[model samples]
Target: MKIILILVLFNLQSGSEVITAEFDDARACDLAALRTFQGVTAEPDMRPLDPAEGASAIEGTVIAHDSDGAEIGMYSCNPSRSDRREG
Candidate 1:
């Protein structure tokens, strides 16, 4: 069995932010990431998880670019823990 792990990175003023999540498949993960990105960008008070926290979050490939073509954020999905069976 395979599991989808999504990792999202956000470039912030203070520092880079990272978000990690798990889904059943790539499509689901990407869709969720897109919605989350829109919501986070729309809300000022919403802050992304710190790098350390993101690392802990058991984790697509969508990248957000600026007008100048600078990558501001990214979403990556990959397989994780295929060998570990769920109890």
Candidate 2:
């Protein structure tokens, strides 16, 4: 019974350490850097379209990210074009 208790305590402590290490690896994301990587150069126009109804629209391109920081795909609003890569 003593040996079993020791093993249980060891497992619990090891599990807690693993959880703490995972939290330590977490980092805050930089919004500006992420936008720049996605090809969003500047803020989009948000002016109202109609006088009676208030609406806003933005036209730009979007690039998808892959595992190795490579652009996996892209989509454009102005030309209505979309390009995706197949694994």
Candidate 3:
């Protein structure tokens, strides 16, 4: 029982391999196929985002250009989007 529990915990925590999933630009959702030994896992997608908005809630990222982008107040993009994504 302890071994089984440990294995489950390990998989859940270390899991980063997103299955053949896709983030939909149309609805701003993801059709994720999670890992499941017994069956084909199909998780629900996220809600859509407002295209008009600068940053997105799901990723909190924006298409930042050095010229058009503003870091003072309106736009504040990090050095890398990956850095912001982790936060």
Leading candidate by TM-score:
1
Candidate 3 per-residue lDDT over residues 1-87, each given as its tens digit:
000100011133455332221232312221111122113113212122245657544333222112323211111112232324532
Clashing pairs in 2: none
On residues 1-87, what C-alpha lDDT tens digit does candidate 1 reach at each position? 445645455656778776777777767876776676656454223223345543643232445654454555666667776657778
Better of 1 and 3 by lDDT: 1
Output the number of the lDDT-best candidate: 1
lDDT of 2 by residue, 1-87 (tens): 000000000123344111111111112112322343344223322222232356433333333344454333332222111223446
Candidate 3 achieves a global lDDT of 0.22
Winner by TM-score between candidate 3 and candidate 2? 2
The reply for model 1, stretches above 4 Å from the true place, is 40-60, 66-70, 84-87
Global lDDT scores for all candidate models? 0.57, 0.26, 0.22
- Give all TM-scores, in the order shown: 0.53, 0.21, 0.17
Error of 3 at 76 (Å): 25
Q: Which segments of candidate 3 are over 4 A away from where they belong?
A: 1-12, 20-46, 50-53, 56-87
How far is 45's C-alpha from truth in model 2 (Å)? 23
